[model samples]
Target: MDSERDELLHTFVAEAHEILDEIERALLQLETGRDVYDVLQRVFRATHTLKGSAGSVGLGGLSDLGHAAEDVIEALCRGDLPLTTPVVSLLLETVDAARRLVAEVERGQVERSTSHQEVIARLQEARRGGPAEPQGAWATSARRATEDDAEGATSIKSIRVAVEKLDRMADLIGELTLGRNRIVRTLRAVRGEAGAALRDEMEEQDRLCRELEEAVRAARMVPVGPWFRHYERTVRDLAHAHGRLARLVVVHGDVEVDTAVVERFRDALTHLLRNAICHGIEAPEARRAAGKDPCGTITLHAAHERGGIALRISDDGAGMRRERIAARVRALGRHPAPDALPDHELFGLVFEPGFSTATESSHLAGRGMGMDVVRRRVESIQGTIRIESREGHGTSLLIQLPLTLATIEGLSVGIGDERYVIPLRAVLACCDLPRGSLAHGGAQGLMVRRGRALPCVRLRALFGLGGSPPPDERVVIVALDGFEAGLVVDSLDGEGRTVVKPLGQLFRRVPGISGSTILGDGSVAMILDVDALLGGVVRDAVPADALDERRSAPSAAGGSPG
Candidate 1:
């Protein structure tokens, strides 16, 4: 009985948080003066349901507070109160309070941690004394029938599965994939009639496994829209606090991605967006002086691209200045003349450790911002991030991420005796580069491909594998974002469908390797981190993760194929 009751509380907490997200979004919408009547109604229904749900679960304090907040919204709906900035702000604050209460519930605590007396008292006062405003469309919409808010009714085609259960299922599928690989490998040796029959049966089984893998991946996916919508409040508050008018425009966020990926990037994107608001945006007077709109704009866009997801965050504010960056670089005593590096590489320096243009620190952001952390997170998921900035125009960051981290389509290649999987999407073309044609002293080497010189690195030399290379070396030309590079290997071993698995602690810290995958022959191969591989070639010069060694650089493989 206690187990069932605990489960109910968990469900309630989850539902409450989602409702609070909706309420917070509605409050932001209210601030914009759009569909006041309908917005209030939706929030009213949500709040009423929350109050009733809390009461049913014996959280009286939360229920009472919700009642007070409900009274104020009800007043606004009836034209007894106005839909002004104060009301919306107060309601948003109330939403925060409710979030805290729900958190306590999530912690398996029946006892409330907060009375929220101050917020509740102010809400009641607003309900009683706030002056009525012109009815407008509110009065007419208020007359329309709305079902009792206390009732929780829903029609949905879904089942609630614990996240752990889903993860376990995914793990099992991964194991099954490994087994399938082993069996398929064995079948390749057979050549008689019985072997042909076994091959046909194996094909059927492979089809089933692919379908199951896709189903599981689909189950783990969540739409990026709701997650993206939550940031509207963040942008609004940040802009207001800084005394600027900034709008967050989210486009095509309806694209779905792995739920884990969504949660992982939450803080990374927040740090990026916060920087956009605080530092990237220009104040109203300055904007007018620059002959631009007083209100700056921030755009968050997501879409499917190149067999993966591409997310771009851009701002119409004073873009980064190359001169200022160069000056800062010189001040830091960097050996490279800033002019020697290309514009892209120069802009990337801003992500280096302790790199910031802010003159002072604030409670929100300053000194040691998480741009490096952001890059690590992106690269950890086998994704790539690139920065684009224009003087006095704007700056944009584009990030590319694979759809599901559990599996990958990769080109299996050989360096000496070792096999490494280069992400298939990263591959542009594969060709031969003779060993005698290259001259190199440092780790950085250059190769001419398609009549253009591009940075090239030898895998065996880079990873320190002990073996003599083939005279005719092959190069898998890959691109991440706009930067292109070449990885020289002994041979191209064709394409593969590999299931990603974690590596031990030793390999996890390795810079160039991302994760490991088991081949049909049961030999483990390292998955190369194309972005990290380019880290040296790109000449981060000073990496943001140089000091701390980003723990989130994903997994690494140990021991080469014998």
Candidate 2:
């Protein structure tokens, strides 16, 4: 009995935290120029549900806070209280206190503290200042709407699965995917020697295995909407605190991505938003002087790309100045003026540890820590980040992430005796590298395909494998972070679903290689990090005109990416 009760308490804690996040998001929406009455209903239901759940679990402090919040929301909906900034601020603070209470419960510290009482008092003060509650036809309809909202929330069905269990399932599926690849390779090798019926059966089994692997990955996919919504309160509170009037607009909220990616990106996104408020968006008076709207806009957009999702956070305010950033770069003892460097490399300076241009430190940005952490977390998931800025215009940050981390569609290529896998999303095209195309003493070469010049890299020399280019070497074009390069390889080994396995600490620092994977032939293949490889070896060698042509070209093979 004790065990069962403990399980219930754990479940309640998780659910309560989720409910609190929803409440905070809804409260933030109230500050937007939308129909405040409608948002009040959502806040009311969320608070009421939280109240009931807390009471059921014997969390008296949380229940009391929720009850007070619910009363304030009801008064606002009934027109007894005005939806002023202070009311919204008070309610938001209450949500934060509730979140802390939930965290304490998770930590096995359930007793309420002084903060809970403080929140309850504020809630009461907000409600007491309101006029007498209305009781007429309007009250009747409001009551009915509230009841319907409560019913809808209660009727929604959900089940909780521990995140650790999900991770384990993903790991198991990864191993199974690897096994499936091995079976497919074995069957292909024996296809000519085996009987017709036997080959047919084997083919069917291969198809089923592929389907199962996809199903497993699909099961772990989650919409990024809830995570985006949770940031609404953060943006609202931070903007007000910084005296920068800003609005957070989210688009394509229904776009789905790997749950792991969403979880990993939460803190990075928070830091980015905070940075935007602190350094990107200017004060209201400054904006008006600059002939811009007084209220700045920060928009987050998520959408499907070729083989992954692209999340863009753009702000319409004072953009980053290249010269100023260059000055900071010099302070850090780095060479090449910021204007001399490409936009990608220049903006990436913000992600350097201990890189900041702020004159003073504050609760938000400064101390030069956020962007570097963002970059680390992003790369940890095998994702890429890029920034775009125009002075006095705006700044946009784009993060491209794969669908899932467990398995990826990869193309295998051979160079001499070793094999390598390049993610299909990064592989643009395959073309022949004609003989005697050497330039710059073979350090870097340009491949002219169909009147378009593409900067190319020789893999053999890059890895120091001590082998000359073969007569029939093929160049595999890969596109990453708006740059395109042709990778010289011996031959193509076709495409396969490559299951990713993490490398040890020793290999983790190795550049150009992301992780290792087992091939169908039981051989180990290195997974190429196309972005890192291109960033390291080709970005500087590639001319600006060639890359401009690459971007102008329509096909991904030309390195033009959405």
Candidate 3:
């Protein structure tokens, strides 16, 4: 019985950690966005989960803390106590206590410390605005009512499993690689007309394998909307602390992303939003001086862009000061001639390690690691980051990320025997390029289109596939950040959604390819990084005339006035 109890306790601890993450994410979301109803539901669920699990494990102190948190969340849901700073602070402290308790449980001990009681008392006071009434008739009646409410319970239906179990399942599925190889060999060995039937069966198996992989990946996803709330609170406090009136505006809240990615990007997003409030926005007085509205506006918007999620953080504060950044760059001995640097390059300096434009370190800015860390975290997920700033107008950060780390929609292209996957989101269109239309030139290499000659890079040459350009090779036009380029492929196959898998460390440094995927035919197809491919082409050649003219010109009816 003791062994069984120990096993249950271990399961409780693991499940509690997952709930804590959800609670943290929900709190963050409440801070940034106005999804009070959804945030309250998630917070309540997490606390309720913890409370039940703690009680079952005989951790009375932990269960009591969970009960106190549950009460506060309930009150918040009922609109009894609004989500004020003091309330949010109390909730954050509650989360911290829950975390410490979980850790104690992991160590096979229970902490009977007064910290839990103190927090519970504070939360109760905050909720009631004073101490409880004496143990009179009214109090006894209220206690009896609460006890009756607690006793009207339902039977437990399900058990919470550790995420590690799912992870282990994924590993076991991954080890089916050897079986896949044997199946492939068997299919290839079938002769004559039997080969076609065998190939069909293999394709079916492949589809099932891909579906299984996607399901395993989906189990790991947690919604990102909850995490946006905490930033709302952060923005509010930072505004008050800095003597500025700032409002946080969230554009899209219903969108979801992988849980691990959300967890990884949480701090980076918070730091970015904090920087926007502190350095990106002007104070109320400064806004009035500039003839702008006195109340500063900071917008956090996310949407599906290309094949990935684009989160744009923009502020109507004073845009980046090139002169200040240039001075810092010189001070750091990196570049002395700031005058020659373009706006993009100048703004890029913010991500340079230990480089800060702020004269002094404040609580919010000038630690010098904010933007640098932001860049690292975004890039760690194979995402791209860019900044567009207009002096005196505002600064907008554009982050382009793949829709999912585990899967991608791909347009397969072939270079000789080698196949590559061009993310369908990145592929603008595929057009036939006649042999007569090819024009080779200076640094910009060959230009294919007519009006604005786009820099063209041969896919075969880029990937070192030994083949001459095909007579009827087509061009895959990909546009990124307003830059358009055409990739010349030997052959264009149709499109399909492909499950992307990481290439080992040996080939990680290889240019042009981001990752690899297995095709329906069981052939490995390399996934192309359109940005990198176009970047390399542009970097080696003279910049092509902006491709804006070639773009299907906007219709005049709903378009901006000429």
Candidate 4:
């Protein structure tokens, strides 16, 4: 039927785009990287695969382009054409044409887009000058056919599922989790024999519920490798444009994160990489004078840490000048004494809006932008980013992100009568705030625990709630990166799996609060933005009327979160 054909066409287009991205990365690698023969063979087979699939789908234009590209690859493998800059550039342009053809197919025009004659003509012209194809040239290292096992059918390790379907599954599982929490809470009050029996069975049900929730979230997790690899061409092109040669090195890239994380952080990561290339890396002459490698290195590393994923993008470049950044902050009147601030806080100033240390703006960077967008994007994902730099050495921006935004291990704490959920991952320790132990530091206070001092922010005062500090005030130590801060609260209610629901546009810009969740007693609990709270972005005073929606416990918290 037409429906089946359309579906198959859609699948082919999706896969073809992925193939194009891989070809671009391999082509870039061919110029500067090792293993040229292997890379050439891979390119040859990918082109063949593209051609076969495009033909099967009735995409004659894409198939033709693929065939043309295959000829160029064959010439390379035959040693008839050299792998020079121009060759790589021409092949990359061919990829661009193929991508346009794929887009045309995606738009329901499979038979034609444009002729794609310009690039194809260039390809043929380049081939005319090469030596004639030698006899049996493919024998030395043959391009692979689509490999098959004992059976002719290829075994599929994965299948494409619609993201909408996965999202709905997550929504249903979240409700189940909330229902499980309600059951656990209701069972706690029962103490009689029959009640005890029911509670024992409920415990087993709870275990099953947890397993189901975890399974759904795990299904949403995707390996971070391809997502990072997508930016290789960006780095390569940017480095070449600025006359600063740089290479991206990926380490432990197989670490998996939720697909939602990649969706939200893609633009943020791109901006960060742009900043690294445009501002961080130095010209080859300057690098040689500094006794460093002529080609700068940008390293990307990902790993699971602090109950979440930590993505580090670092570069061996000119690095950040702390003194210059501090002087600029003071000159801008953002901080009067930037020198007294810690390195993390000082470095964080670069993310302030329109804050740039560069004297002039250019096409790529130094327009007093980007870093602020990085901060906002990271916060929007309920993640944190910090900078570490040594002058004349290098700079690294480390981002910490939750495994899944749907739910979290949350510790409930009371401020007045209102409850809040501090993501348990960000909560280091909870203790009573001993009387007079908080030393005053301007508007904020500092808590000294075990000889280590941490800045403190009281939720009561920050939220504009009218309340006096109780004799037994509590402090929750929440930290990101190497910086620590104490969140002053009233009481600890316990811990559990808290399902997150976004607060609509009304409170979207509210500092120190990420989202909301339902707690056991059928009360609304605001999820604390540990990143915001720890980073010292305290609100002067949130209006009392504006906070009634958050502070007042909703009469029906058991209802579905919208």
Q: What TM-score should be assigned to candidate 4? A: 0.80
Encode model 1's per-residue lDDT on 325-387: one tens digit a residue.
898888887636986767888887877878777788765557765788788788778787878
Q: Best candidate, lDDT-wise?
A: 2
Q: Give TM-scores for every candidate, taking all chains together and pairing residue i with residue i.
A: 0.80, 0.79, 0.66, 0.80
Candidate 4 has its poorest 10 consecutive residues by lDDT at 145-154
* Model 2: how far residue 53 lies from native, Å: 4.9
Candidate 3 lDDT by residue in tens digits, 332-429: 88877976877877787788898777778855577798899998788666677788887788899988766566666788988788888988766777
Q: Give the per-residue lDDT digits (tens) of candidate 2, residues 1-562.
A: 3787779988998788778767777877776659778878888998999999999988899899989988888989998888887777778778768877887877777864668887787688779994222224223322332223222222111214554565576566556656666666666656454655666876787677667767767767777776676566556657776777788889998898877677677668878888898889999999999999888889999999978899999999889999889899987877656678877789888889999999998655678988998888887777888899998998999998888777788999998899999898887678788676654226557777766667788787777776666678888888766666888887889888877877899998888899988777667899998878887766665567767766666653353211
**Per lDDT, what order, best first?**
2, 4, 1, 3
Q: Which candidate model has the greater lDDT, 1 or 2? A: 2
Residue 370's lDDT within candidate 2 is 88
Q: Please give the range of 10 consecutive residues that has the lowest summed lDDT in model 3.
A: 150-159
Better of 1 and 2 by TM-score: 1
> Per-residue lDDT for 339-411 in model 4, tens only?
9888988999899999998888766678787899899999888788899999899999998888877778889
Against the reference, the lDDT scores of all candidates come to: 0.74, 0.76, 0.69, 0.75
